[model samples]
Target: MTSGTADSGRVRSGLRGAAWLLPAAIVLVALNFRGPIVAPAPVIGDIRADLGMTATVAGLLTTIPVLCFALATPFASWVIARFTAERAVSLSLVIVLVGTVVRSIPHEAALLIGTAVIGIGITIGNVVIPVVIRRDTSPERVGLVTGVYTSALNIGSMTTSLGTAPIAAAWGWPIAIAVWGVLALIAAAAWTYTVGAGAAWRGSDHDSEPLPVTGPIDQVLDTGSVRTATEQRAAVIETLPHPAKRWVTWGLMLAFGGQAFSYYALTAWIPTLLHDEIGFDTASSGASSSVFQILAVVGALGVPVLANRFRPRVIIVLVAFFWLAMPLGLLIAPQLWLLWSVLGGAAQGGGITIIFIVIVRLVSNDDDARRMSAFVQGGGYLLGSAGPLVAGALHGATGGWTAPLLTVLVAVLLLGVVGSVSARKVR
Candidate 1:
């Protein structure tokens, strides 16, 4: 066989051999994304006491990361374009590893700066992983893989929430928070190995070309005429609506925004809300709130199955029902907090997965995937960063949980309305 044909064969063989590794690496990297962020929360008191930080400054530890996820997204998109997705993943892990270590340095400045760096790293991974999924996975498996990807995120959050306090008790908060760096390090090493293996087998260091489009764009491009790659891309671009004008794009953004807003708002206040409203002690409230975190694994894994069986609109309705039910249920019946938490957790988890599934299915190429993912996530996170503050303010102003719960209820309603509109089948 000619060298070109032999090289092509080797590339395919290498990809097939390493297919399993990609998913494994994705899960491991995802574990680092949320674990480091949440790790400090369980020991925030320890950190505050050790570093002599005021409550406002202590709050920045978590707030900085969410802000980074929002404001740094465009930069994350640029990183993916500049460095190939594989390389970006490696770079992100390196940054996360470095940030984790820095955050353990026992200085308040180091703590805040390290959290920001970790947020930036996680932001890069957030943008690029969707690009990687779109580029590497088969069309049919996109939902399943996206589900797994999101599920890992929740697993990481839940794991860190549960484990950090005990570790802090045993060693100290810094060690407890710093220990997650091992996860980032291992994921980075594994991803680098896969990248090297693929390069070695393919005899090429370039980013893999975008997978062939199979939708309307594909039909438009494949007119049995010779066209340069640029011409084909131009043709595809002509067929699609402008990103700003597309209803699906805007709808997905709103849907994601509502989801994120609700999630952060609840996460910030649920334990306190439970304590105040239901007469639950601190320990019981915390354990109850964990139901919200742990049940997300179910929601994440279930979205793909629902996607396979139902229309996107149907899935959105189901997710919206649960999301809406949680706040309303909380407002009407504080005693049933556990049930509301379960529903809300599943809804939040499923909400994110379904939005991702739609993005993967709707975008025409890897470039579109990266841009759209960044756009949706960036907008969503920007709104989400305010959720806790707004809820807290409303609660303090009213001297009751009613107003805060009602605000979340309204957000959930908006989520359902826009999400259903967005889920309309694309022609």
Candidate 2:
């Protein structure tokens, strides 16, 4: 054999090894996605008192990151596609690390800015995760990994939510936020090791031919500077076919987006709604909020078992019915409805899992999968940005949640519509 062919074979071998390391990186980053945002929720009061933030301002502080997801996603996608996924992951860790340090400061401005930075990092990682799992793992294992990965995201969020307050009490909020920097550093190290191993394997190969997945890596390198891979991923998605034309794509979008509307909206405004509308005390309202979050973690963890046995579409249909009932049931009966709220959050928690699964199954190829994933999340989150804010505004204008509740009620119905279609046996 020619030396060129031998070198090429060796590089391919190395690349395969690097690909295998992807899941661990994905799991770690998935768990870390909501850490920056959720960790501070439990300690907001202290931050408020210490930083002199008003309620409206604190609301902005939270919303700033959500808005970044909407705005930064396109750029983030472009980034992931341009630099090679592993390099993109590495870059995002730096973003997270920088953001964490910034938030560690006592100033409100710095904290909010840092939150936006972290959101940008997480946004890229979030959009790409399913694509990574779907393309990298064997198809038979997808359901299980999807479940664990989604669960990790919720657990990560829950971990921060539950642990952040105590952490703040011990080290102060600055240190609390800063501590996450260590997590980012660890993720970055693992990813670097994995990618380097892949490159080493390839570099040592005797052949000079490019790898199969070189398209995405070259696209990333071609589209953007080495620094902005997430931006590159976003750019690549805009140029692709509408994956929604496929049943799985649309179904996942509807189910997932509808679920996100409820999840993000309630998480944003639930405490206020309970406190203001239900006359619950501040502590009681916050506790109620935590219940929703904690239960979501449970739902996320539980989806894989169901998906493994039944057809994914069938499972989606059942999930859809349950989802439709949750919010509508709450609207119908508001008496001691904290349990209902928790139930709704728990059901909606599956939305993230469904989103991951659908993207993996919908597209026929890796490029399509990543593009579809970006489009769905990009569109879904843009819509999600409106959910809580619009609900708040509608309630403000109407003087009751009548309009807002009805809207979510309709959204619940539509979620089933989209999910049922997507869940249909993928063509």
How many backbone clashes does every candidate have?
0, 30
Off by over 4 Å in 1: 1-17, 49-56, 200-242, 275-287
lDDT of 2 by residue, 82-141 (tens): 766666667777888888889888998898888888878877887766666765566677
Stretches > 4 Å off in candidate 2? 1-21, 48-56, 169-172, 197-254, 273-288, 324-342, 394-407, 425-427
Give the TM-score comparing model 2 with the true structure, all chains together: 0.77
TM-score of 1: 0.87
lDDT for each candidate structure: 0.80, 0.67
Model 1 clash pairs?
Answer: none
